[model samples]
Target: MGGATTEPADEKPAVYYANCAEAKRAGAAPLHRGEPGYRKALDRDGDGVACET
Candidate 1:
């Protein structure tokens, strides 16, 4: 019984932003947890939302 989805091991790598500014510039600001380019460092309040203004 499979309950989880399977992803290709060679799938495109996850996105990463050095900082919120970078993310904003890339139009990926306000990233949320579980989304690509989302990091704890980006989430100042640890509210699961990153790069939020």
Candidate 2:
């Protein structure tokens, strides 16, 4: 008798980051909430805004 083997699934989601300061040379506009840059720039504490506070 043959049995099928099952594999465990990945629990962690993929993460992305915004452009670095070096990339923009400090002249790039700031990112706001709900933006890609904001998602990468701000540090979340308990699912709330941390960097802005």
Say which candidate scores most in lDDT.
1
RMSD to the native, candidate 1? 7.2
Tens digits of per-residue lDDT, candidate 1, 1-53, equal: 88988889889977989999999999998899999999898899999999899
**How high is the lDDT of residue 37 in model 2?**
40
lDDT per residue for candidate 2 within 1-53, as digits (tens), equals: 57986556865443334444432444333434564344534544434332343
Per-residue error for 43 in candidate 2, Å, reads: 7.2
What is the Å distance of residue 48 in model 2 from its true position?
10
Q: Which is the leading candidate under TM-score?
A: 1
- Taking the candidates one at a time, how many backbone clashes does each contain? 0, 0
Clashes of 1: 0
